[model samples]
Target: MTSGLLKKNLVCRIILICTFLYLIPPQTIAAELHLALADSTCAPMKEAGLAFTRETGIDLQYSCKSSGLLARGIQAGIIQADFFLSANANWMNSVVDNGLIDRQQVRPLLSNDLIIVTRADSAIKIQKLADLTLPEVTSIIIGEPSRAPFGRYAKQALQKSGLWDELKPKIISKKKISLAVADLAKAEEGTAAILYRTGLADFMRLQFTIPASASEPIEYYAAPLKTMANHKEKAMFLAFIAGDHFNKIFSAVGFSVIHSINRAPEKSVKASH
Candidate 1:
């Protein structure tokens, strides 16, 4: 967005906040929770919003994208947001590497199992992880590995599962989780895609697995980007996303909240397949 346009959005947000406070009693205006989600297709995030509005008086306004695209936007100074929750840690790290996130403010918010998704009408019966490489699978859609953390996690899982080398050439890479889902939805020709469990939850026909032995459980993180102008609201929203309230929502939507980062040795993680 142009500088003038961005400034207008900020002013509009501020006005909205002020208007909200004025309508609600002073005792009711506890605080504001400004959140920027990776995207709305993420069921955990969508479900959590319903509860967030109930438990906390704080209002949350969020945005979404494939983790890769979000990183590029933040890195390029194009899109400005506060409290960025990503599908993978790599994107969060990239923002941090560029000094966009303060070390103290960043947190590993959640984790999700990766899955191969197909449209509701697919006839090919996929029972195992290796089935993805079959010639019958016309296409494989996924988020851009470099920009989307989930995409990065998906790539890691593929490598760990021994499918990366074979399927790399056939993967239809995208820049947003929702777009990947859209591609899956449009797969009347029976295309396949890899995405977070939450990304595919709305589709009843989609299948997933949590292998006892497989790739490392993809750890995702959230951080306040430097461009986030609202500091207090961002922190409150961050706390809410990591709180027990949000955790329950995440659990219901097939997500695992990592809570906080553990600096100890990385154990043998059976990546949630």
Candidate 2:
């Protein structure tokens, strides 16, 4: 064959190869699964993700934020995740109602306790919810009720205790629980914060455990996104999440594992959007 004809044939082959590569679906080439988790679950879920990767050789990418914000992101189609681990059922229900997640696949995974904490070195002595109203208690920090489940739980506890009216004036709201914890750590002597009992640092002293009766039960739910329903890696990750190893990871961080058989019927929340 002529050299010129050979060169033309090679160019045509290269173009066809490039076109075929461009037409391949993204999922066919991507081996990583994405998880959207609440910030409070960061430690355990991260550990779990790493463990899953080690066991199955499937990579994972995760985003952590308040459950409300994550849910909103999913509803707005701004976030794409194979799975979502929510801090509360309300936000999970919102996504389910919006068709972002499959309702039948929603699994109750963990539970947490709400507690009042102050810096270990603080002089303020708070024995109960009522002490929050004392003159010496200068400021109270909590997550933003609109974007964080911990914040909503904190608000409910205060309202049920009849302390909301008095404490509202001193309340300082943060977009996430981690920020609230950070603010409390740097706050003055009288500052206190309501936070999840899980993942509390040694510098924070727990003053009170809010009674379960004071607010709705704090439950964490894991739901697979509808778009990833058929993903093989997602199935592996879900199995890992339900296994004893994952349970121990969360329990070590003070989270109570909720077994499938023990899951109670979760209350539904009206979809906000």
Candidate 3:
């Protein structure tokens, strides 16, 4: 080929390469959401986090622990969290007292009921809170009130039902609500534990639901800490959590909707400022 023709071919090849490169999609930088959660692994928060990424292109950096531990972290100034979704407001309230988290930015987000659960094989039929007080019933599994909001709410509900005093001494307290539930039928670490639940989805093991009328409704809350420099993004994410996007995911995963009163009295919990 002539020199001029060869040059033209090289130019065409370069153009083709450049065009192909331009057609390739660029890498997207997903924003990081530092979230502190107290629920179980692969639980509601994780499910919602997945959906949040799909909808908003924000990647969640989630840290799941017990609500009590999360609360203690804020109290101890140990956690640097952008968002905090706790099982109860009491912990978030403590964070507010520290003046570290934006109080106006805090709001109730979701709620779960305190259910009474028992082993599926247990012969003792417990339909009411009063049944827990029976002398023959050796033990009852409950969450530790000091840390688990479920446990705290359980105690409060039992107290409201005039049953806490009788049931407190005959109980096995576990740090995590799931741990307590697991202990009801199984023994761990040589400790004779009998776990119980109120309304966990595990229907086969649950003795019977004690009903919301028997206890104060459990409250869940979320607060954006000062760690979020991008307030607009944080607000957007919070709205996604409160709106149908997050709620739908929560509902699909055995979580009763926050506004579902008939199923459970969950306030469509939100705090906007």
TM-score of 2: 0.88
**Candidate 1 lowest-lDDT run of ten:** 264-273
Candidate 2: where is the Cα deviation over 4 Å?
1-30, 261-273
Question: How close to the true structure is residue 252 of candidate 1, measured as C-alpha lDDT?
Answer: 74
lDDT for 253 in candidate 1 is 73
Residue-level lDDT tens digits of model 2 in 1-273: 699999999999999999999999865674888789999998788888788877887788888899998999988988888889888888998998888886777877888999999999988888999999999999899989888989999999999988898899999998887888778878999899999999477899989888888887888888889888557777777778778999898899899998872343344422222
Q: Put down candidate 3 lDDT per residue, 1-273, tens digits, no spaces.
A: 699999999999999999988887643545677888875433667777887788778788877777888878866868767888777777777787777776666665565555555555555666767777766567766678898777776777778888778876777777876676456547422222222232254433454555666554555667778767877678778677767867777766545546421132123332310
What TM-score against the true fold does each predicted structure earn?
A: 0.72, 0.88, 0.74
lDDT of 1 at 272: 23
CA RMSD (A), model 3: 7.6
> In model 3, what lDDT does residue 72 have?
86
Error of 3 at 122 (Å): 2.0
| RMSD list, candidates in order | 9.4, 3.5, 7.6
